[model samples]
Target chain A: MIAVAQPTTAWYLILAALLFSIGTVGVMVRRNPLVMFMCIELMLNAVNLSFVALARDLGDIKGQTTVFFVMVVAAAEVVVGLGIIVAILRRRPNATADDMAELKG
Target chain B: MELFVFVLASAMILGGAVGVIVRNHPVHSALSLVLTLFGVAVMFVSLEAHFLAAVQVIVYAGAIVVLFLFVIMLLGVDQSENLMVEPIPVQRPLALIVGVGLAGVLVTAIVQARSAVQTGTGAGLDNATQTGDHDSNVRQIARSLFSDYVFAFELVSVLLVVAVVGTVLLSRRPARLPDDIGATR
Candidate 1:
């Protein structure tokens, strides 16, 4: 890997794909809701990386603009999700996702 | 130079992502998330999306991860979770298969479309020219955000406010407000 070649868009895209896959696996394998949320964040970041890469590749600003919106949405998501988790855990300490099957309060 | 930075940042990203999943303690996972966020920010810099990179660090690493840590402490669920227990015997294996299949499909699609992509198509992205426009990237993003996506930008503000209010409601204890109102009545 000592070559003086610059990494291409393909390289970045491949990396993003791998990252997204890892996140998916984490979401499925982890029972802890908080950790699962973090994995979702990982997947979001993966998509953001690809968006920026493609923006650079196509010389378009739209990709960056979309990423801006994504970041906002992600923040909102994490807040609301953690809030629900807190509420659930407050009622039943050490509650995992499997324990919260019923939506009733 | 660019190659070196790309390689290093990729390493940071993948390593942190793995750490987030494998770590037993929630706090450790949160810290690992921070590492991945920083790496993504670095990648944004390399891609010349400087403003997004800054926002990424501030919002994701600074605020979001802090919120995660705070929740961890508040809930005291920071204790190590048992990773060995398999509630569903075949779930992990199935998840691994799904992840690998998804990656394969994505990579194949990207490689297949690699040649069809037309580069430098959209009024080339603004970069700092030899002339004094060092903030070209920021300026272009602002122009786009305020002009074309302004409505969507405003909607985001609404979404954020709703999120804040909803979270407050969700986390709030189910006080006997209704009964209190009835009593007062």
Candidate 2:
């Protein structure tokens, strides 16, 4: 009977949860570093979505501000991560994550 | 209308996320990520965080995704990956199990804590109390950012500079030592 009800905060939270889970799976299963990095971005965006939803539900601006900070941090993270990835891939083109075990010794 | 937008955006987000993982090519995954980021931006608009919506588009979709594509092209690693060559036999199944468990736990927690999200006594997030002043969302965010969060804002700027310098050092080729050059000459 709830045909056209607006999405509640809980709906957004659940969606975020699902997205985070997918990202986690991608990071775990994918061997390519670039794909794993994208998965991390997915997880970050999921967290941002939940933060915005809760901010609206609680009538708080702090949550949005926190999301902004999170975005900034994520950008920095991506920059550093991709730089490392580019360096590694440059040394051995098309190297998988498993091949980066040279430092294990 | 709201429900439609929510459902459509959720579909975009989930589909793009799945595509990112399932696609064989890194370029495909990167494009899928763009889809997911845009969907998140749409969700931001639906949540009435208009300024964040704009930023989500600009910073995430515009800047970040383009950077990702640039890396892919620059590296020339756009070849399709082999998804079937699993060195660890149980890794994929184990990851799936872990992901499912995480989603289950989070959904349960959200459902249990649903009643805790009562409307607070914070300032209202309305738009345009007077004519032609329709930027209340951005205005309030700016006030908060410049006031209580100014110190953190400055720290983030510092972090960005460090990241930039570190990336330059990390990605660039190391300079040849003078002795090595003399020996080669």
Candidate 3:
């Protein structure tokens, strides 16, 4: 039977890195806080992907286990983050990250 | 088959990420984020992490994205934003440069470590390393989580409780000023 080579672990790692970089750029350049939060989610997912890939490659359950903890942390972060964003919006309607420069001093 | 699925999932992931950043409306960005989350879930399934894939869809795409949409609607900021405006003079250029540099570094590291990663000593004895007793992935994970990582698991629960309290505290409105004092101001 003819065999096909599966995609390498490096390929998954590279894709995760690319996704992480994109998320980083999005966070850096976006003026909207909500968009920035989405970028953070993208970054978390990227990390989760890499973790799963490594787990599969090494045949370890630890990596898969870590992804669960990471998800929990990400969920907590989103809750706190969106709450802060909502609070900011209440104080100043239509505020962007640029308008949040009151603490610049 | 695996390669095809990876390519499709990665395309959806990256495209959704780009959509999240480039879309003018926050609501559109939220929807794009949903796509990215679903794509990640697909990737999880491809990696044989079925439990994580289920949680990714349920918690991320369901609860988290719904929370985001609720905030977007509550704030009434769904109107399209002016994308041309850049309050920070060099933010976009700097971001692009840094992103490219980071990607290059990561790709280089992965390439250099490819051989070591593939032939490492920790390879599992079987393909289904964690599927003990023919139980599901979720069951095995729960076993390890409660037995070996119980402390960390309990700590996470505590952290979640604290997060809930913090969210409530942060979102509370400030005390209203006296009616008599408000008129003078």
lDDT of 2 by residue, B61-159 (tens): 998888899999999999999887888999999999999999999999999988876675566565545435788888889999999999999999999
Please give the lDDT score at residue B170 for candidate 3.
77
The DockQ leader among the candidates is 1
Largest lDDT belongs to which candidate? 1
* Clash pairs for candidate 2: none
Query: Recovered native contacts in candidate 3, as a fraction?
Result: 0.70
Model 1 lDDT per residue over A24-97, tens place: 99999999999999999999999999999999998999999999999999999999999988877876788888
- Output the lDDT of residue B101, model 3: 100
Off by over 4 Å in 1: A1-3, B129-131, B177-185
User: Compared with the true structure, what per-residue lDDT tens digits does model 1 show for residues B1-185?
Assistant: 88889999999999999999999999999999999999999999999898999999999999999999999999888889988888999999999999999999999998998888888887668877633688988999999999999999999999999999999888877656543222111
Fnat per model, in the order given? Answer: 0.87, 0.80, 0.70
Candidate 3 lDDT over residue span B70-182, tens digit each: 99998887888888988778988999999999999999999998887653345342234545544466765787688889999999999999999999877776567524322
Give the lDDT of residue A59 in candidate 3. Answer: 72
Winning model by TM-score: 1
What candidate 2 gets wrong by more than 4 Å, as runs, is A1-3, B128-132, B177-185
After superposition, which runs of candidate 3 have C-alpha atoms over 4 Å from their true positions? A1-5, B118-134, B178-185
